[model samples]
Target chain A: MILQKISKQGKGELAFAGSLFLLGIFVAWDTSKMVIPQGSSIVSPQTFPYMVAAFTSLVGLVLISDVLRGRLGTPDGAEPGDPFIAPSYKTMAILMAAIGLHVILLEIAGYVVSATICFFGVSFAFGSRKYLKDFAVSLIFALTVYFSFTKGLNINLPAGFFEGVFGK
Target chain B: MGNSFSMLMDGFQTAFTPTNLMFGLLGTFLGTLVGVLPGIGPALAIGLLLPICLTVNPTSALIMFAAIYYGAMYGGSTTSILLNTPGESGSVITALEGNKMAKAGRAGAALATAAIGSFVAGTIATLLLAFGAPALADLALTIQPAGYLALIILAFATVGTLLGESRIRGLVALAVGLVIGLVGADLQSGALRLTFGNLNAIDGIETVTVIVAIFALGEALYLASRHTLVNVEVLTMSGKAWMTREDFKRSWKPWLRGTAIGFPLGVIPAGGSEVPTFLSYGVEKAISKNKDEFGKGAIEGVAGPEAANNANAAGVLVPMLALGLPTSATAAVVLVAFQSFNIQPGPMLFQTNPEIVWGLIASLFIGNTLLLVLNLPLIRFWVLLLKIPSHYLYAGITTFALLGAYALNNSTFDLQVALVVGFIGYLFRRFGVPITPLIIGVILGPLAELYFKRALQISQGDWHILIAGPFPKIIYSILLLVIIGPMVWNFKKKFANKK
Candidate 1:
């Protein structure tokens, strides 16, 4: 069981390296497709991208070898969060959903509504189980941001459903 | 020298006005508020402050932005000393001694030294900036495109090699950023490089979107998934907030030494505060009479690293203000702010817009003084910020991040772009790719390419032109040394160990 967990962790790291290698190939492939015009400045636009592609792909290979030798990368751990606590993927899923909902509802429902939903979902993901209280707090926070930013700071966050409620 | 002093006086007039002072005060206050938090960083704080540019005039906003920058630095030290959870590598050195002091019931003393050390370092560094910038700009005026290309190469090499946990990871981050930066059109040839046929891609991926997403949104999601259990404990102050005379005597020298070590590093393209702070700590530990007390609650340990951190922040401005080269993340953000105001911050800035240049520099000084006042005398009030629940804090960050990104252009596409970048940011955190090099690459990548092309254009396709100039030659040599220097040192140390 312990070995299985260790392998899972190693697999995650290897996948990260794989993604980086693929990204490099994509950059190189995409750069090759760009049509070079005649009499363009002494350097073609492809020069820097090619360098970047080679560097990324090469470093990605180095990382894979390092990981294979049991040299795992160190994540940023200098925060107040508990490192011992097993990360909750359920919470991650909820938060991802929250962000997606916020984006989709932003134009349809308005800044305050979408932000309130996002705020509430985020609070829930963070383990604030007081549902009614959380919703109230999220609503108030969203409304406060909407008024302060839209009226006070002149940033026109979309007022979709609540347009002209206060007669802007 | 005399001319700069007079220009600074003119700047004092602009910073001291009632409206600007209010904005400056607000900037520092908010800077500390967010910076004191463990997860949030100054880049995200600046993103949250973007809408203020729309509300106020450019000069006032610039003043506010400078104040916010200083405030965040001061606030970061506070968290290091109190919680021992450094938000960035720059504060990691401080956590070693300052947190020990806090645990030993010297929280107040630790906080005091950090505040006073920042003041001393900030004042001295600003004075140097006032005098040194014009001289550097004078020199920069003579540099060619090849020289600029060499300097940019030097920055890329140092940022890639010097920062984060591993050299390869840092370099990979930089390369990925270069790829992302090319997502727009080719400005010179008018050819689409990687836009995938979207016309809006002509203007390029929005930097504000990338910054807000990567730092705030990415951080928020990373925190949510990785951290569900609380582990922070803010130590209550047990003694007088003021440092004793003995503490003062021990601290003053380290402050000076730290300032001396930090400013030059900050002015150079290797611009992160992490190196200077570590060097300052090492110097203090090596020279201390209380060598046995090094790991324990030693005042010099706290004083030196904190001062180095501040002086290094100030040192970043020298390159930024003079040559329009951003040596650090804060400098990059400030350059973006200046660009937003349609004010180019190159050598011509002093000639074209003296009011804004001097005023911005002077306001930075005022902001430092304001930071000292806010953190030192009323520290008790600020310590309460640590009690804010992680959930609410991150939630607020997410809301503000999305708002800031959307507000920048009122475009939904940017929000989607932010979400995509945010996911990438989460993967980066999980895998340990440093964000700073990535940011530096994204913002400066296009500029580096432009300089490379121009230098080649000048020699009419002769690659040797890159090695022709004295400045380019010197800078390229430094780049070579930066890449090779550490490996040689490590190898020598390993050999000594084997012996």
Candidate 2:
């Protein structure tokens, strides 16, 4: 059983190594675009990025080596132990949609109105079936924040087009 | 001593104002409630409250937020003792002995001792802060880039100690966060580093956004993806929420010793609470007559570690307030909050804002009292929090987290960043990369780089200054040993085993 657990751990390390390699390649390619000036003792803008890229590449190679040596592995077992396991793809999809809608509507709907809608939808997505409880709480949270920030703290949170509604 | 007393009195006068008191109670109460929930602690609570703080009076809001900061540390111990869920990283030590006591049906004793021990340690640590903070500030005025660099190095070494099981993975996590933290516009040159042509990135990734993503949202994502959780049975109090006379007799020494050890260690930039907590536990175990009771269900183990953790938290403030050094992740966040208020927290802060500093220190005392009062009688009620279904709890967490991140800049780009970081955090967690180092790296990495450059500029490209003087030489020597000693020790052990 112990050996089995160790073996399972190895697979997870392999995937991490692959991800690190990809990240390294992207960083290296992105950083290589910078051209150094003719006469300056100062490091160029890309210097730090290139250094990080090189380090990342080295680490990635180390990780791949460890994986090859079967040192790293996956979690011991693949099983859902809790009733509230990983959220379903449907739930993630709904959450993503709600957030996207909120962002798109933020400028037009204004901070208060858009945030309220965002919270309400997200609350429902979380299986908060008590609509009244969710709405009341979400609105209080959003509006209290709005007044506190915009009025009390004097922060210039976007009032959006519906600034007329709150008279900001 | 006389001046310190007067300062305390003046501090109390400011702290005791009706508005400040109300804010303190509200902050502590909320802090405790949030801290009771697994994985949400003072740092997130403060981050969530930071935008709101921008709307309120800076001193009052900061006072309340600071109250919540330590208050959550106290509250975190409760959950660790009763539910084995460490509400914050510091409380993880508490769970080692605390949960054992709970399973042994001594949950009441464990909870009471932890609460009372935290109170004693917190109160004494406050006194230390009140008296020693000024002197420390005076000393910190002498700090140059050389000292600051050493301090950051010491702080970085904490990553190795706190990271579980695999130090290599922890270092990797720290490196990743440091790289990410450097992804915005350069401070000195005003040139962009790795924003990839995004205008919003010029302002840099908000510390709150990165923190909320990494610890709170990322934690949620990791737990979700894990598809597994320890289902501990909810422990109920079998008796009064007070320690027995015998229990008190045994616990008092450990509490005092822990306070003595933890307070000073916590003042050192590298001497984070975790080190002192372990040290306290070791001391208590070594000296206690009831050593066998440890790991089985020792009250002193819970009492000592919990006290040490709280004391160290209070001790962390000495450097943070006096020298602008953040000893822990929560301390780092608090440092960010101070910066956000345009109040640089260094030696000058004492001269410039005595009331604000003293009032905060005084409020820590009041907040601890309020927390003890709220928690002791309400122990049973808090246990009900453990019954909160994971689904509803995590859902609420996700909502607040998303809302909090959005409010940081009101930019959707941050929300997307949160989602991406959340996923990456989940992957990191799945791969066993500890997240605390990531937090340390993100917060400290930028500051270290800036300081390195600034100091170099001051000395005109003098690299020797980085390791100049007796103090800096000692720091480099220590750093060298820390980096190299482990590898050699491992090699020796392996060779010996082979033989």
Candidate 3:
């Protein structure tokens, strides 16, 4: 009875494997377009990516077979536990949007401004209500970083509008 | 010995400079803060600072780096005791007994022993470094690749034996890491192997990104999902911070033994402090007059492991200075720092720059003293760190991680890579895979591959050359036992039982 109940539960791994297989095939095909003629003894740059694509597909295949054979199913005689559910699509969408927006803003605002804003904003997302503390900490972190790296250690960071204004 | 003493005196002169002392204090303070917080290890801190370390005078810069290392070691025990969370791998062992002590209302004693033991070990180990480094350096210079390879094999065996609940699982984790490491660029052919068409992946995944993603971020996500937050009660202390005479009587011997064991092992390649702590714990369990107190809150267990952890931390520096080999992930980042200074870490380093070498050694003694002063009297201050709301703490950690990633190259692309790796790390954690081995493989993978290929090339592809020299043969023999010996013993036992 328990085994039957377990078998009827979610198949997240199978679905995940299927999605990965498709992603691999698509990426591999797109990458093949960037390949150019290469000299002997030097494999085309596409070779590595293609190999990865192949490996991913192979792993996907094994995963699919395992799912089919019910090997991916929770073991028999195991005590009842919650079914493994996949991540919510809404959460995935939020993560993607945050990353996309961050990337778009990176070059325009430069590191100092962009990093400060992102750090504060991200903290707010994680349920931080203390804006004053957040702003103060983030700014201090950014400024200290600016001084430590720019003045003390001497590494050059990206310079935006405030570049010379900050004495960079 | 005379030259070493004189060299240390010169080092003391350099390290005592106002600027170096200030930097050491600053690094230790920051490192302790970061180490107290879960999901932030010294590696991430050093990586974030590597670009900046390039500009400073190497000696002062190194003083700060060493300070950060000592701070992290001390800071790691805080979270382990207070929240049952280990901020770094070394602290995991602490969590085993520390949390138990906390539950039993002996949090103060646990914290006190850990701090004092660390101080003792750090002091003794630093002194050892001062006296023994020159001789070790002279010895290391004569070591050929064969001997070095053997040392690496021994380290591998130790890690394999010590990690994971089951040896099978540990080996599986190690093998998985090795496979992932082999996925990237093939150095000999200049051919990328597993980038999967992403231009970003052409450089392969940075070890820092992989480690942070897998261990730190992944741990966060895992904990978040479970929502199994333990409401750890703060234990108020009863007496003065000083240890009782009985406590001293029990702790002194273990402290010395831990130092003795940890120092020698620290010089081995891949000989991280984690193994020595475990070994010390086992030895203490066997030898302690008060063995029943173990796991139930033994002060000796706390003292020995904590001492071993710190002593091993110092011991590992010998090779890091002499041969430029890093035994732990944190040391690997430091190796990168050395390279950023355009200084290769090997035997020639001492010849070319005695000031930087000896100065850094002297600074460690000073840093340890500083850590001891800061750690003990400030236990209450550290405990207050736990009072910060969990939501805010997590948010701050995530924000720092994101900013750190962005600060590296000022590319949002890297941030996205960190995120993806973080999510992937979450998945790996959800599965049964251990992440440390993966990081170990990634960091050491290229080096191992490079050496293996060079050794092979020098032999014109003769595979036997790997086993030609006595050193290599000895190393291989140990590696062979590490790889196959357990399985054989298991099989033999199973058959014997059947018969």
Candidate 4:
């Protein structure tokens, strides 16, 4: 049973290392495809990319060897007594989805609206049950930031829905 | 010396303007608030604010940003004392004795010592920065492209070694950052390398976007995902803010010693508050008169480490200001802030924009004084921040993170990039890959490439030119030693064990 758990951990690390190795290969392949224009600078752009690709591949190999040797990069418990607990996938997924939705809706729905929704979504993901309070807080917070950025700082945020109302 | 002194005076004139002072105050207050909050350090605070600050004047923006960095350093100890939860890694040592002191009803003394110690250390370190940076910049001005490339390589080595548990993981994280940095069109050839045919990819990813994603959004998501598991209980403050005379006597020496130890370590490439703090703790434990109180709430433990932590934070700025090299994660974000203002930090920074450079150094003094005032008399007010619910705080952080990314270029594409990078940041955190190297990589990768290519151009594309210079040779030798020193020691240890 112990052996199985150890191997599982090894496999997990191996998967990460393998992906990294593949990424290195992809970088090398992609860099090769880049065409250097004639009369460009003395050194081609490919040189640095090639070096990076080679370095990445070498490091990937090193990581694989290190993992296979049963060496894992363990957290050193800098904050003693506070053992690291991996975050749940459900919460991460929900939060990630919420952020993605915010990004997609940001220009379409506008900053204030998307931000409010994102805030509430995140609050909910973190197990906040007070819907009304969260909603009120999110709205006020988003609106305040919106005005501060646009009016005070003069950075034009996307006023998609509010453009007509704000006379933009 | 006279020139630097007068330059600092000019810096003070700029830093002390009413508007700049107000910004400094705001930054300090905000920095302290975030610093007192669990899991929200200066790096996240700066990342969240970087976009907003971009809209403000460069000098004022940097003044506020510098204030936030110092303020966070001060505020981290508040949580360490009051809740045993350190808001930053540097404050972990303080919590060891600080929380114990709180439990024993000496929380006020611990809190006062930490604040006062930080002020003293901060002031001393700022003085060192004021004096040291100019001299270092003068030296840096003479370094050629090859030497600069070597220095960058040295930075990679030191950051990789110091940041993570394993050098391999650190290097991997750095390489990942280098790849991310290389995604835009190559400046030399104007050839697109890794854009993948997206119009938004042509400009390359903004530093602000990467910073917000990794430090702010990534950290928030991680915290939110683990929200249910980590229960933070705040300890109520009970005593007066004033410390006893005996407490003062015990703390002063440690404060000075910590400053002495922390400043040099901070200036070195192995830049972090953690090492100096642990060293301070050990040194204090060794020399304390009340040795019996070492584990169970020694005041010296709080005083020394807190001082060391703050001094170390200040120390980190020296290399950053002088060399355009960020020694710590927070400094890396600040480096991006410099870029946002079109102010490149390095030897030329001092020569070109002495106002910004010296003004920032001068503002550290102002920020430190403001932090001392805010922390001491208003300790109760700051303690209330601990009572804020984790859900609301983290939710607010993520919302601002998204907004900040969007505000960078008013593009949803940047937000999407932030989200993607944030996810990568989350994975980096989960896997125990040190994120600092990745940040440093993203910030320094282009510069390293620029220098490397410049060196090659100068040498007519000969690789041996990289090591031809005495400076580059020395730097290469140091890199070799740093990489192989541990392996040799470990091998020797194994052989000795066999005997």
Candidate 5:
């Protein structure tokens, strides 16, 4: 019965709202457990967090009720394209995975390797046909940025594997 | 007036130095480059460059940042005109008639009018900022913490209501941002709030990471997802760079009108450039001698919205410069830049660092003129930027996004934060939740809380002090109206419909 009710309404919006509400509750609960130092200030550090928690919970409730009342937001003027159509979940998953992989590999493998892999992965996910060309372009692009930041900008990018390669 | 003029002249002197001029030019160039590219705007562009700015001189870095801010405004109209894709929210209205103009093979005229209108409006708005900012700063000094709190509330109401499809969703996004903003250790009592026991969370989330994640990475994911579904055709330019005599005659008045409409609205916290551009388009259509040309490629249409768009960009600087209040997402990122430089931007900023403030104001004029020069003769070069394949473009952007995230504190954890935030940003985009309020909330939440607490402290925990005094009183009245006005209107409409 609950499943049917949720499915009848905007499922995604409801789930998001419910998650936010839960998050608000967690925040409030967590804030309540915090130990404030004696005579800290007229307004305790917990005060703002509690207010934020309350506001978040209130908004979450309002959103939930609104969604239940069939006031689900239409995506007109919010973005350029029609919002009713489902985006390509496969591509999204691929991109997300690529980003996750990049994050995991960044420090271990260094910027050049991880960035190239990420660039190539993203390009492939976007339907680029030429794998060889994409790989070459990604390598060049990553290296260029790496050198620019390291040499030109004086900012340190991780050179994890390259440290041994460059005999550093 | 003489003092202001002399100070502006001093500003020009600072801005006209060789290095500063180069920074201005470089900023305008990069700004246009990013603005012409789809899926990136000035905020991400600036965010990407924030790390680099840390290594440079503060004044020059600021000049370039300011240049990029207005420069992107000019370049955004190019994509809107040629590809029917708005590079930023402000340029969305330009796409409506601008794309039509491109299709009608008046792409040159449309581009020219947009460039010229931007130049005019930018100059006029900078003039306003130059003369008006100091006076406004002086006035802003009188505002107490309560008044400031009320002002922040007004900003929240305006930003929440004006952006997104529903105010509830906007507020929800804002609340989420506030929660995120509250994650670090509390400065007042030195207690951790939402760190989850992570050492990196001690400093909270970096603003650049959040911005780049939401604007760049999130946008790339959305674009990649929709890549197969949407096919955009870049319109080719076929005419001279200059607008015809007739086009010129029709465009000037609309340019003036757009500036007039956009500047005040920009100064106010009412949702940035979208409203003004649409307003300009409507006004132009109403007053146009050739009304039929509006939808089918009207020069007036291009001129008005483009002017409003640029004017609004300049207008956003007023509150940012004078009151240290960011009215838009880009301004919020700029606020981060200011904080990073250890320079607090508020009424005191003007008095403390007139050189940086005035120099930045002066650089806007220089950047505007340079943008006009670049856009007019180098139109074909910018058009060639469209020839880059989508796959490579997006791939490059993604790489930069990751690089930028990783570069922040050299911690892999920031990258992880970025990925998570990027996913949430994608969800926000997919669900039609506006990202602007989230950004505004994240940046402004802590500041608002500080002021709110200060106000209460001043009154020894009296809640009524929040609405005390004339300024806070006036602001609360407006806030009440803003919150209740729309509800009453909707209720009345529903009642009438039932009757």
Candidate 6:
């Protein structure tokens, strides 16, 4: 009870439920905008979406009531997670930035460089301080995957800096 | 159906080929490799390997997939016993007694019983699958579209209400998946429903990408945020890694009992894997003479649930092969594997693709024997995999997940989609929503909708068709009872309290 009060998870859940409600409304709005071609259609494309919207909104309301009854969502650890420990937003932010960089620079910097950076950044986020080892492993992994795909699978990956070195 | 024996013999003929046998071996090893990783389950394991399934022979590949499915079961138990940590949800109960046994210096007995129990249950259940699937497929063919509509409704309802701690949250998660699944064009009309006017969105989100991104990539993101890495003291096995005579006496009954419980639960859509596993554990606990030794490492506790987990896995394939229903997350991924090869697994599957169906069934038996023989000898090699640091394991997963998602259509846009979906997955975990329902919903929703509309079309817009057939009538009646029975009980309990 004391942890619940300090965590304020009840309020956070209420907000989440409210957002689900809004999502329901958005789905309804999207459904209403659909232009159904004229026919003797028994169940149109919009039928399932409408049902889904109603269900979503109804469940959202039910969740809000559940929160009102002091029921809050329990944090889970599908992996080996310590739910009591506060999440490291700094680590998550770094992870996001790393992935974003990987996506954007994948074409320009190539699969090996971008993937290596992604892997390195992710390792750092997970509290790996050994930079040289992490980078070396990451680079080797990316290279093996890239070459395996290119040669064995016959899939072309962007060469970037190594353009014409690996092949056309 | 009487010729199922001959068909099985034919299946063995196909599965025994050197190439297929090699692939099955490779799959088992790869499966165990992924299974030992901290957060990777068979769903994510199978999803990562989808790219390879495209190029490989379907029969050989399916044989491999079936082996992977069984191999992960063996791998999960290994972790639970040695490290006091479950690699997957199904093995959570295994960690309870198995780990205690390990600490008591009986790690070998625990490992042996688990491996043997799994093999016993797996072989028996695969027999049930082999004989029962054809008969059930014949039965499934008789069921009308409305019956199918009722069945999926049952799937959605049970998956929504029966899973997780909160019914509201599960249903809400299912609703979200339905919405996401609806993003592609309508199945029959081909009218785009929620494309939001994007040119790329017309083809709908790729299931493989979503599965990989959410299960693998999303999991990595969630793990990255958790910050703390949990490492248990890995127990060293000694004193002969084989079960003693007394250990065998205690374990055999539970294995048989666990098979009975697991196979039936797995056959039905409502029987999510956790139930049978936990049910097996509870049943063993209730009936055991050594009940006092339960928490301290009773061999019955290890044997029953481990058997149930494997049998339930085999059982899940029944409905998936006979009727196109996937009850659990792993089943959903396997269903996707069949679909990836443009093979829709239904009553017609055996009629259409006998080799793939029978070959997969035969491979299950082969894999069970393969693991039973192999796991004991290779226990040390498998244990060494646990030495991989959590940070490096997760780092490698992140890279592979990104690559897997990127390879889907070779579009950077899909990379962004993967990120967004992975973020959603992270949020779902933070809120304690069971994700299996969400995956089941996304994969099964469209099919359910198609069945519903087809049922309606058959009746010329009459809604009563849903409850018309005997199957639908029976299904809906049972579902109604399942839903309403609790409310009535609560009402009476409240009245009694007032008195």
True contacts kept of 5: 0.74
User: In model 6, how large is the Cα lDDT of residue A167?
Assistant: 71
What is the DockQ score of candidate 5, to 2 decimals? 0.62
RMSD of each: 3.3, 5.2, 6.2, 3.6, 3.2, 3.9
Model 5 clashing residue pairs (backbone):
none
Question: What C-alpha lDDT does candidate 5 achieve relative to the native structure?
Answer: 0.83
- Candidates 2 and 3 compared: the better one by lDDT is 2
Give the DockQ (2 decimals) of all models. Answer: 0.56, 0.21, 0.19, 0.58, 0.62, 0.54
Q: How should the candidates be ordered by DockQ, best one leading? A: 5, 4, 1, 6, 2, 3
DockQ result, candidate 3: 0.19
Best by TM-score: 5
Better of 2 and 6 by TM-score: 6
What are the lDDT scores of the predictions, listed in order?
0.83, 0.73, 0.65, 0.82, 0.83, 0.83
Q: What tens-digit string does per-residue lDDT give for candidate 4 at B94-139?
A: 8878999988888889999999999999999899889998999999
Chain B TM-score of every predicted model: 0.95, 0.92, 0.87, 0.94, 0.95, 0.95
Interface C-alpha RMSD, model 1: 3.0
Score candidate 3 by TM-score against the native: 0.79
TM-score of each candidate structure, all chains considered together: 0.94, 0.85, 0.79, 0.93, 0.95, 0.94
* Candidate 6 error regions (>4 Å): A1-7, A38-40, A78-84, B484-499
**Chain A accuracy of model 5 expressed as TM-score:** 0.86
For residues B451-475, write the lDDT of model 1, one tens digit per residue. Answer: 8888888889899988896788899
TM-score of 6: 0.94
Question: DockQ score of candidate 6?
Answer: 0.54
Residue-wise lDDT of candidate 3 within B205-241, one digit each (tens)? 6555555555545555554544443445545554545
Error of 1 at B336 (Å): 1.2
Residue by residue across A66-122, what tens digits does model 4's lDDT show? Answer: 877877655323222245465577888888887888888888888888888888888
